[model samples]
Target: MKKLLKVLSILIFISAAAFTIQFYFNKTHPKIQVELKDNALSCNLKYSGLEGSVDFTKDEKNNYYIAYKDRIQVIGKNGKSCDIMKDPVLDIHSIDYSKDNLYYSSGDKIYRYNLKQGKNTVLLKNIPNYGDYKDSLLRINGDCIYISIGSATNSAVVGDDNKWVKENFYAHDVTPEDITLGGINFGKYRRGAFQSYNTRSLKGQIVPKHFPGNASVITYDINNGNSETFAWGIRNINGMDFTSTNKLICSVGGMENRGSRPVVGDTDYIYEIKKGIWYGWPDYSGGDPVISPKFKSVKGSPLQFVLDNHPSTNPPAPLYQHKNVGTLGSIAVDSSGNLKSKDCIFFYDNSDNMIYSSRGAGSPLAEIELGKNSIISSMKICDESLMILDEKEGYLYSIKRGKVNAGTEIGRNIYLYLLLTVILSIILILKNQNS
Candidate 1:
């Protein structure tokens, strides 16, 4: 028994030592490789080990500024990182830079960080922050900042799909325009549209619109410090950018299968953001009624329109539609003319880790695969290179104009830590049984 205990102690010590070394190595040198080619565009690994990075933007001098959940940093062209803001906000989702200011969104607030003065000011606040889709995305155009706020509930009817209701009981989806309830309730709770899970609504109930509403896009004029709803009724826009011609483009996430009004076979969309337009939600997807047989789940009843009368039953269709793309993410328009087109568009799909580019809406070209186990959390075009952030692996890759090359690996496999852990667990179990 003494010898057995001795052996176990040695094994445990060795395992701890190995784990420490590997953890340090992974932090210092992350693994990265690339072998992506799509018609004269060659993707390459630029930077790795971007811990906690969700979004990044480039400044006028072409320096990279990265947003990490609570803080932001600037990576100089010399490859050195300098902290710009430390623990200033929570849940940082998107970031943009203009003139001497760094603009970013976190929680229910948008902030502006003056670089020269080293001061951070809240530009907008009290944005709808509840529900599964609270993170907001922002893009700056001239003196205006366009912000996209996601819905408080899936399909506007709060149900079991909402996990935040236990904390914020009154949290529910709000509209940007006055809407009349369709006299429909969802689930046993009998919750009505735009009402809390425990609340009920009357048939033909008039729900007033509120500023800075959920599931809508609003514009903030930097000059006047005023915000106005740019568009409404859009479900969730994961990414948005402006084309060279100054047209706003967005990647809209489709309805999921877990909501009270479950919708299946719904297609994601690429849209040109138009002012005051109702890009259908809860009723229409891709400009088609949810009551259509295509959206019905096999094990569930047919889907119904959550709203009786939509602002427009026939909303404008998306510029492009993607079926089974799986949670569309960050989008970018090539304003630099790198792809030799007027405004080449690129968007990422988190489900498959594929980046698809198209000359226009209908001409989606072959996708560029970045390898396995990659979750592209954010993407942008900077300095004629497409910068992709792989949040799962803490890697940042750049796709530029180059010759196609085969995939290559550098550094050790980080998963070896997991293997060591499993082995240690087995040894402990065996020792306990023998004792």
Candidate 2:
């Protein structure tokens, strides 16, 4: 009887010890499975317990500024943090740091928060935010701040696919340039492109260009305060970054199968952005027209071109196509030379919870796996360490070369958990043998 009590005490002690270590002391040491390359990397859990954090940026002083839905906070190396700005009304989307200012988008406005003066001033306003793809991403490249605005609806029409119709009935897609519609109405309301859900259009009806319109990358000059469309017809660019060669690259999400103009077998893509170029959307996917039989719905009729004419019928093709990747987000170029090449880029797959390192190829050289439950919202390479924010797990993981931590901490807790269980089983077996 006393042997049984002794065994129980030992098991209870082991359980308590493991719980304390996992919750308090275990600073998750993760691993990177670099299957393609022979690169030795170290992954570490830099920060944890951030639930609502959306995006983050680092300054020259190593201070990490993280943006949440309601506030933005600056955290130091010592794990201490304080809110730099707070607003309950702000639904902050993306963030970028340049010089001494941090720029971010919230709702329909972009604000620049100056670090020296501790003030945030509105940089731009009236961005279209009343649609399905409303995340406005901004990146600072030299004197140009490139901002991406998403289309208001799927394939230009505000049909039953839009859940925002109940709240904003009159909201629909806007054009960056004047476009002549084909006058094809969708759904029972017979709504057309560039109009409200209840409105219709005639053939050759012109939709004038609106400033800061959807489906475009707008470049705002910091010195001159001038903004112009850099490129148009980008369906929904969730990720944007400049390569080491000063070329802009974006990860664009393709059309889904759940819209009025449902496009089957659509795949997300990465594109090299060129100034004054139009990457096709609504009427095209990956530079191919939607009228192609490949885009036809599985059970429904074929898709027809919605535009009477296009700015450029021959748009540039995608640099890389991510087959079966649901939505790609947060692209980062490795300018720090930590990877094999300076031009190597890393992007997140929101559906698969994996990060891939690619050099503009159809297949990735290596992939960073964060399991199935992780939702990597944003990632960047800073100080030679790749910093990734897992929004679902509420942790910021860092990956570097062999210069930092000695071992990988990926699944380290599970190893300990299993080890304790094995020890308990052995003790129980020996106790039974003696009895």
Candidate 3:
């Protein structure tokens, strides 16, 4: 009995002490992994934040391109690069190549940079960016250039007489047909002011033919320089891509924590964007119609189609609905067979200090969980390795599989956990022997 008590006390004391040390002192360092909950993926820092949105180019000699705001640098594996163009335009959100020309987005314009001719041309300009939703992601597939535009305001419920709307629409030469063309309502889509949750009423609303109210995916035919809306009714979708099925998959970041961004528990999602369809925004969240929580109305629209802009047709469902993702960076498709999925979508949420990869449905799997409040500005996959830009440090990191670093969840000092286990085992052994 005495030996048993002694062993129990020793184990308890040792466990308590080790746990305290792990909790109070253990610090997370740079480690990469297949999943945030998994072991370390080998990590190595490469470039600075100056190397902007990472993408590979058609040019075989220069495999990758990074937009550094001031210039586009084409780089090789060993750090050799040449300036494609110097700050040709500031605020470049994304950069890519289509045949002979390079495509990049700066604010509302999709600038066509001719690689062969070495000249700059504004492919499409005067796009709308209302609220804090102006992170344009440019993707070029074949001859068409796709641009994902974020909303101008949170809900964009400006009254019919909003001067900004009139000016912006007129400047862009949007016609009544264009507004009504996508079955989109203009003038006022929302019934109430920019407050919390309000009951949606599409009745008695007036509008022009075309409504450029919120988020939209547009395509510019590089051959004709003519652009058209691909999809609409999205809030802020910075990370979107086309899958092998010729369909779209985008990470839609809804209602952020800010003024008028109603915290109705609306989370983030991976949207499968379809043509001529409105993926819910403002009045809906996570593929279901939702009454803004501010409305204080417990009773709301049905889970699926809450407030219908188009009652006849249902909005496309989310590919994967994530829980409250913020500051979503540009998305990349993983074709690196080394990864579990042949074609998986990966994105970073600066708000969560985590990177995510699409895993069918449910929650997007956390690929790499970063620490020290490291903000991931951009990410790109190269061969067996994944490269990431840490905005806070302005450093880029390359990650591949490595031995899992245990005790990250319990604490960073994995040795402590091991030592504690060993101590407990020895105590048990001694106690048994004594008995």
Cα-based TM-score, every candidate:
0.83, 0.86, 0.67
Backbone Cα, N, C clashes tallied per candidate? 0, 4, 15
- lDDT leader: 2
Better of 1 and 3 by lDDT: 1
- Residue runs of model 3 more than 4 Å from their true location after superposition: 1-41, 48-58, 159-203, 211-213, 256-263, 292-313, 325-327, 401-435
lDDT of 1 at 63: 83
The sequence of per-residue lDDT tens digits that candidate 1 reaches over residues 213-262 is: 98999999988999999998888888898898789999998887776666
Order of quality (TM-score) = 2, 1, 3
lDDT for each candidate structure: 0.80, 0.81, 0.59
The local distance difference test score of model 1 is: 0.80
The residue pairs found clashing in candidate 2 are: 29-409, 29-410, 30-409, 30-410
Best by TM-score: 2
Which parts of model 2 are misplaced by more than 4 Å? 1-24, 27-39, 298-301, 403-435
The per-residue C-alpha lDDT of model 3 at residue 25 equals: 42
RMSD of each: 10.0, 4.5, 10.5
